[model samples]
Target: MKKTIYKKIHIIGSVGSGKTTLAKEISSLLGIPYYELDNVVWIRNKSGDIRRTEQEREEYLNSILQSDNWIIEGIHNEDWVSNCFQSADLIIFLDTNYLVRTYRIIKRFLKQKLRIEKANYKPTLDIFFKMFKWNRHFEEVGKVNFFNKYVVHKDKIKVINNAKCIKKYFN
Candidate 1:
């Protein structure tokens, strides 16, 4: 049976997996507020900093989760974020190809540099390279292992494997 889109949705994926973009789209579609974890984590500056203490972060996340409708998007899979998954009506895991995700990341970097796309924080080439490394490593081990160990139940999990699959989900 097709499940109705939930009031609370959580999107998880490796770096550069388009989680933010998809979250925005889904939020718009569902008329729900969308929160990007990076924005909550980093304070904007010429040099960004992790602005929140653990308590502060937890409080902020708790407030958002308490809302009637929301979409939370991030690569974080820590215990703190597990509540999002446990409470979500739908949990999307994007598994786009490595090269595809890399291309998107590079394009996003260029757009941010050109000011075509605004981010809560700027992306340096160093950060871009680090994201690439993380994405590659995620494909090799991190994401798959996490899924196998923690996401064996598929009742609410939707793995979007390609652009077509993504479009299909929206439709």
Candidate 2:
């Protein structure tokens, strides 16, 4: 069977859902640039991170959407990000297992603390605790919310619960 050519992909999932890792792989394989939605919302600086104004965020996202191809990965499911789902040729919902996500959260925190992993934000104790909360909330609320709100785009949505399954798409 032949695979569809996806120029614009929006990958959504909870923290530690492998969205970034997958985005990078696809971007490298297809030679398409990938973006992290968090980067669009914040201005990262050595001194500290600053939140972008709503207008600025909107404009930044619009610029990417207007491009020829891109892979956007983030956990944001807010109204401000709706256009990304609408414009994407493919919407990947990384329904990674809850236990797996929990493990990743712990492992990631350790790596960040040890300087083995570079984090976009400062890996503080507060943020570490929040990751667990986010994971639980995602399982309890975010998953249902995504399906309910984005049902209109069901035709393009792909629910990936396993990492191994991803290789087939690239092959």
Candidate 3:
């Protein structure tokens, strides 16, 4: 198998599309640090998860971008994260089927609530329902918007529509 030479990687996908899982796997395989966009966007405070200002978010991302090699993964396609996409040696876009993603989202939430798995945020019913809404939004709107925005970087983008295809990357 050919070894992946990419030093800086970015992954974007709909909720439960396995972006985090793939990022972690690639990080372990390449021994590169992995950062989550959600963590950068929201800071955990004594009160709860408070969203950082746009300037704060940019500053947080800048710190990660300064690193020589990193893997960043999230579902965001906002302007604030465009720099990450531009800097990445490889961009992974997971397009898993809606049914599969929905299943994973439900399973993941249950696991997080049961303390079987760890998550960046506290699992609540509100967030759980929002995941479904986000999933739909990604399928209907975000996918088109992402393709449109990143059309210039088509060469660097790897669109993985099947879950099994991702296994080959690590192997």
TM-score of 2: 0.97
Residue 58 alpha-carbon offset, candidate 2, angstroms: 0.4
RMSD of 3: 1.7
Ranking by TM-score: 2, 3, 1
Q: After superposition, which runs of candidate 1 have C-alpha atoms over 4 Å from their true positions?
A: 1-3, 45-47, 167-170
Error of 1 at 147 (Å): 1.3
The runs of at least 3 residues in candidate 2 whose Cα sits more than 4 Å from the true structure, single-residue gaps closed, are: none
Screening candidate 3 with a backbone cut-off below 3 angstroms (N, C-alpha, C), the clashing residue pairs are none
List model 1 lDDT by residue over 105-129, tens digit each.
8998999999998867667888889
- All candidates' lDDT scores? 0.81, 0.94, 0.92
TM-score of 3: 0.94
User: Best candidate per lDDT, number?
Assistant: 2
Ranking of all candidate structures by their lDDT, best first: 2, 3, 1
Task: Give the winner by TM-score: 2 or 3.
Answer: 2
**Top of the candidates by TM-score:** 2
TM-score preference between candidates 1 and 3, better one? 3
Q: Please report how far candidate 2 places residue 158 from its true position, in Å.
A: 0.5
